[model samples]
Target chain A: MEKTIIVNAKSKTYNIEIIDHGLKKLREKVQTVWSPRKVAVITDENVGPLYANQVQRQLNAGGFVVEVLTVPAGESSKSWMNLEKIIQQLAEKHFGRQDGILALGGGVVGDLAGLAASIYLRGIALIQLPTSLLAQVDSSVGGKTAIDLAAGKNLVGTFYQPDLVLIDPTVLLTLKSRCLVEGYGEIVKCAALVGGDFWQLTGQIKSPQAIMRNANALIEASVRFKAQIVAADETETRRRQLLNLGHTLGHAVEQAAGGRLFHGEAVAIGLYQLSRLFEQKKLTAVGVTEQISTRLQAVGLPLSDDELGTTDFYRALKHDKKIKQQQLTMIYLKKIGQPEFYCYPIKQVIGWLQQELSQKKS
Target chain B: MEKTIIVNAKSKTYNIEIIDHGLKKLREKVQTVWSPRKVAVITDENVGPLYANQVQRQLNAGGFVVEVLTVPAGESSKSWMNLEKIIQQLAEKHFGRQDGILALGGGVVGDLAGLAASIYLRGIALIQLPTSLLAQVDSSVGGKTAIDLAAGKNLVGTFYQPDLVLIDPTVLLTLKSRCLVEGYGEIVKCAALVGGDFWQLTGQIKSPQAIMRNANALIEASVRFKAQIVAADETETRRRQLLNLGHTLGHAVEQAAGGRLFHGEAVAIGLYQLSRLFEQKKLTAVGVTEQISTRLQAVGLPLSDDELGTTDFYRALKHDKKIKQQQLTMIYLKKIGQPEFYCYPIKQVIGWLQQELSQKKS
Candidate 1:
């Protein structure tokens, strides 16, 4: 069965199609949304070797000229040098206003390509071919595209929505077991934010394999939940900040871990640590932390990082883009499925992290 | 005397305030539209020496903490290196979402600063303090912020509208004579598009000094004309292409000149040359070329480039972002004020240019 979730952003509205093997119908699916003479398939070394040739042949069969532009696969590919390279290639190839880009890898390729699409000739048609579970459920559904600066991850980016997003659960089969598990961090985060049937569904899935078996349902739920939140707040002025539940500390932890942790792993740890601290402070309902930890651990997500108390972690936390006027808006759960935001001083946030670290060590 | 032109773009609606010594009221005017705790006045070496401190002091007096960031004063400043530096500086300084950037120089500074402001923290408050006549009348009023690339000019950009635009004609007093005359290229282009009173006023003005004498009225007319067109077509899908009356060939001429011709000077030559060719082909009225030539020369603008027939000009023209699928859209005058768009094959455009060059030689 195929499910289509319509993301109604302020700038544009597009559909996220989730199916068993949507890649087989790539040309037909893309043609329905946007028509371009040429399409640049921007992928990374990892996903490109696996899927780029197939995507090119499919689109070529559909009468679209396809060019596969590959970058080194990893977080490092999302840099200014790669961004400039991609844009310069597009221009040198004479990709016009009517041309399009297909981001056909994980979050890094999606972000770098999406940012390129947004600025090349002031934006062109973009279709997301999210090949990973995390990208399908979180990054691909929203229109946030960015390249990292030395200061922080996603410190520089634009909110340019894609024309269409095609998610195929079968592609997730190719993702390594660790990569697959990392995606569940965001899945659990979404489930926690939208607690009804989704949370129950997440709780029932005991392992990564079981979650993959029910991937379609879980992906649809997460996409729908995010679509609703993004539609209401496209620019993250208020409600959109809810989406950053685990990201505040998650980014800091990720930065501190330096390449040892994937994005979702850090987010998983951030989710657990923040909730535990909130419970201790009497802000979150008692036992909510236990429930979150159980769901996360059931999916094999790490609940804490040993290096969480490092100075690099604190520095990354302070450099978060969410900090406005020395104040940070931290998202906490009053209860499962009920998230609330509170403003704290930077010093206070660091103090809470320190307190959490001491308590965990004790 | 002060005149305010309200621009209603799809992304934002802001006022373009034109007055004598408007820099004196910078803080008061900025407070009306946006509130930022800290303001970064991004200026150029040339303009910084003249007005940065005064603007900083004024904003400081209004309880806004002001920081001045300066770059070299030229088109080269609109480079990836400068863009990266500006963005990194903003991140290092911890500029938040509520913080603002005041672009307080000519088109180069405005373009670079505006691009920085748009991508920093995914966007922040921006106020365009356009000092040059060209910027005040054209680039600053529109939400088109960009940095040039090695492949082409404005290949990377975003349509991010400023919260407000402050244009003080008194700043023109400090502009070099060549710079002041260069601004008249865009001013004439605008008058030619809108026709009627704007065109008549443009014709009545005899020289660069006369333009300065009537700067308020001329600037108001040009800004109002552009504001309406931009409001109608913010993304340049259809009607907004009319604004590029001379820009298609103008950009090519400018690129080929290799910094010898200011943007407006190349545009003036483009305006005259394209009109002459259109007249010879009977696509434009017989007197249209004469009228364009007279106005351009009246303002001491150049109407011809000696390097018009060079391969560099042809290459630049072929690389224009406006070229869509080997087809180019050329804007021409139907009469003094009326403009029309005609799509020609890239080959046909080259042929026309070649024929024009041959005829000039004869």
Candidate 2:
């Protein structure tokens, strides 16, 4: 079965296609929007070994010249050094404005390559082929591309939308059990924000395996919800802040953990912790925290890290790009499916986190 | 007296203010659009020593915490190395989305700082304070931000418009005579493309001194013409390509000259040579080449470089970003003001240049 969700962005409108084995139809789908003389398939070490050859062969069969560029599969690959490397390589290969870049890995490759495509010759065609669940449902669909700076993650980037997005759920069967569960972090977060039918569907799915069993439906729901939000607020001026639901604290937790947890794991913990704090303050609906904790724990996703302390989180927050004029805009729940933006003074936010930490220790 | 021309870009509508000694009103102009807590004034070594302190004081008086970031003065400063340095400094300074970047230099600083502002935190407010004639009349008004790569000039960039543009004609008095004359390359090119009254005004101005004497009128006409072209075609899809009147061969000539020639100087030669060739082929109107040559020579601009060779020009043309699918888009004139696009096979373009070079030698 094939499901297509059209995203209307400020610059262009494109489609996100979800299929059982969409990789097989990659060339045909790409040909609809772009017909480049050459295509650079940017993947990472882990994904390159598994699918790069297959993708290259598929594109070649369609009479397209294809070259695969691989970076080491990790968040570290999303750096200025790698970005320059990719751009220089493309320039050396004589990639023109008519050429295209196919980002064929998870979030790291997607972001690094998307950013390269946006600035190379002032932008060329970019098509996203998201293999990981986190990417398929979230990162790949949105046009937000970035490379991390030493100070923080996504500190340098552009909001460059892709020409098309092709998501193949069949690839999930190749992922490790842990990687599959990590994808649920965003799934669960979206479910919480959307509430209603999406929340009920996600809440009922007890394990990663069951979630994978219904990947098509869940992926479509998440992408559709995100697409609508992005269409209305492409630049994230106001309503898009809601999409950063767990990301504010999630980024802090991820930074504090220092490679110990995946981004989705950090986000899972952020969603749970923030809800608990907001619930205690009567800002969030009663039972929302328990509901999120139950859904996350059921899927074996971590809710907290005993190793991270409040000081580490505070340090990370200090460098966050979201903080403006000594205030941070945080997203909280008015109820399941209903999110609100609240501006908090930096000192007050730190105080709240510190008080919550002390109580946990006691 | 201040003359304001508003540019309506796809992302923003900004005012380009032209006034004598406009530096005195820098803070007042900036305050009209942005109220940032901090503003980073990016300039080059040459421009920094002259106007950086003055700009900082102006912005500071408006309660904006201002810091000056200066790069070396030259075309070489527009490189990946400097781009990284500027971005890293902005990140280190904890510059957020609300912060603004005030580019206080010529083309190099404007391009570099504009690119930095476009991607830093996915974009921040950018104010262009173009101090050079090439910048004030051309680069600054159009919002074509770029930095050079090892492979080519402006190989990596973004089409990011600025929040405001301030042009101070008083700065021209401080420029070297050679530097001041170089600015006419683009001014003359715009006149040829927009022939009617603009061409008449530019044609009558016979020297660098005369052009500067009528700087306000000439700059306003050039900016107004460019602003309309950009507003209609922001991304250089079709109509925008006409603006590259002499740029195709101009870039090759500039690259072959290897820093011996200023960008405008190469463009001046490009305007003369291409028109001569096109006029010979009857593609351009009769006497068009002589008209361009007369205007360029009257302003003390070079019509050709004796040092450059056909092979050197061909080598550079091979790397131009405008060439797509082994074809180059060359702009020609139907008459004085009427420009048209003609795509020629790369081989044909090389053949034409080779023929022209041999004739010159003979």
The true-versus-predicted C-alpha distance at residue B31 of model 1, in Å, is: 2.1
Per-residue lDDT of model 2, residues B177-289, tens digit only: 78878888898899999988999998788888897798899899899999999999899998889989998889998988889999999989888888988898898989999
Choose the strongest candidate by DockQ: 2
lDDT of 2: 0.89
* lDDT string, candidate 2, A1-362, tens digits: 89989999888899988888899888798888876479999999999999999899888888789988999999999999999999988989989999999999899999999999999989999999998988998899779999998888888899999989999999988888788888889998999899999999987889888988988888989999999998998998998788888887889989988888999999998899889889999999899999999999998999888644567888997777778899999899999999999899988888888888678877
Per-residue lDDT of A251 in model 2:
90
**What is each candidate's fraction of native interface contacts (fnat)?**
0.85, 0.95
Q: What is candidate 1's lDDT per residue for B1-362, written digit by digit as tens? A: 88888999988888999879999998899889766588889999999999988998889888888889999989999998999998888888878888999999999999889988888878889999999999999999889989998878888899999989999999999888899999999999999989999999988888889989999998999999999999998999999999899888889989998999999999998899889888988989999889889888887889888778789999999888888889999899988888999999999889978887978877
| C-alpha positional error of residue B206 in candidate 2 after TM-score superposition, expressed in Å | 1.5
TM-score of only chain B in every candidate structure: 0.98, 0.98
Error of 1 at A183 (Å): 0.4
**What clash pairs does model 2 have?**
none
* DockQ of every predicted complex: 0.80, 0.87
